[model samples]
Target chain A: MDMRRLVGRNFARIRREQGLTQEQVEERSGLSQQYLSGLERGQRNPTVVTLFEVAQALGVTPVDLIQPDNVKMPRKS
Target chain B: MDMRRLVGRNFARIRREQGLTQEQVEERSGLSQQYLSGLERGQRNPTVVTLFEVAQALGVTPVDLIQPDNVKMPRKS
Candidate 1:
């Protein structure tokens, strides 16, 4: 999967897990609802600061928003 | 520490660990040296795509460039 789509999916998953509406996240993150929607749709490329702010609002680490859902565990040496 | 500074510090540390110079990263990532310097100084907020590109150039995961230096381990329940 593309990195943007991966980030979008992870972000949406985390936000839903937190029971946050787009309106609520917009209020908390100071990002517009349209922008948030676009981000969730994988149409926006957010700045790192924006990612941090949104992750903070969602009560998750920034890395969580970008990690792929199907990451494989490291193989034994 | 600020998130930007943490990212900058981690990025610089990783780049140095890989024995890569800004010029090398620039050539690989197609980002200007001036911008890379600003990022290293914590003065620029890179986009997610930019972060991915730079991380790829540095041979690191995007999350590794943003993790703080002093993370405490979670206590056992």
Candidate 2:
């Protein structure tokens, strides 16, 4: 899957897990609901700072938003 | 410290640890050296896609770039 889509999917999943709506996230992150919706749909590319703010609003680290659940660390030789 | 500065510091540290310079990373990541310098200085905010590409060029995951080394995951209750 595309990295952008992966990040979006992770964001949506985390947000849902927190039981927060897009509107609620917007209020906390100071981002527009339209922007958040676009992000959730993988139609938008957010800056690192924006991601930090969104993660903060969702009570997660930015890494959580970007890392797909299935990614495994490569084994050291 | 500000999150942006923290990210920039981490990026510079990791790049140096990999023994790669901005010019070298630029050649691999297809990002300009000036932009990379700005990013490392916390003067530029990169999109998540850009971060993903940078991480790929560095042989690391995007999460590695964003997560501070000292950050500890909260213990499960």
Candidate 3:
């Protein structure tokens, strides 16, 4: 395993769909807006716990964040 | 928002109950073993994107990660 981009993009998209701002996410998840912003860009490497916090705020599960859409396994370079 | 531990512990407990190891999670999620290890322990602060990857791997949603359990608002210091 090397990289995971789907998660961040999906997360940001979903958040937008839900009409939630980074500030609200921060207020709900106790995470800073700056960090949340970074997460959306896929620039930050989050821990499982933090993932849980963000997930809880969004009303989903950790599994949802990591599930592959097409189920295509990419080869490591 | 100051602290959010429920998410991390809940995630870890669920993963453990599901019989998953950090290596297995890494293998499934395109994440590193060390990073996965840190995530399980809630030591890592994951970005939203990483959160998505982890949730996807677990077969859940991001909402599941950030949604507060009791719906109780903690007083911010």
| TM-score winner | 1
Model 2 sits at an interface RMSD, in angstroms, of 1.3
Alpha carbon lDDT at B27, candidate 1: 97
Runs of candidate 3 exceeding 4 Å displacement = A1-4, A71-77, B1-77
Which runs of model 1 end up more than 4 angstroms from their true locations? Answer: A72-77, B72-77
Q: What is the lDDT of residue A6 in candidate 3?
A: 55
Q: Give the TM-score of candidate 3.
A: 0.48
lDDT of 1 by residue, A1-77 (tens): 36678778988899898999999999999999999998999998887888888899898888898886898989999
Which window of ten consecutive residues has the lowest lDDT sum in model 3 chain A? A1-10
> Which scores greater on lDDT, model 1 or model 2?
2
Clashes of 2: 0
Candidate 1 lDDT score at position B14: 93
- Native A-B interface contacts kept, per candidate: 0.79, 0.88, 0.30
Per-residue lDDT tens digits for candidate 3, residues A1-74, read 32245557656877887899989989999989998887788776675566567778887665555554566779
What tens-digit string does per-residue lDDT give for candidate 1 at B1-77?
36678778888899999999999999999999899998999988888888888899998888888777788779899
Q: On residues B1-77, what C-alpha lDDT tens digit does candidate 3 reach at each position? A: 32235556656766676688777878889999887776656576665566667777777665565554566778899
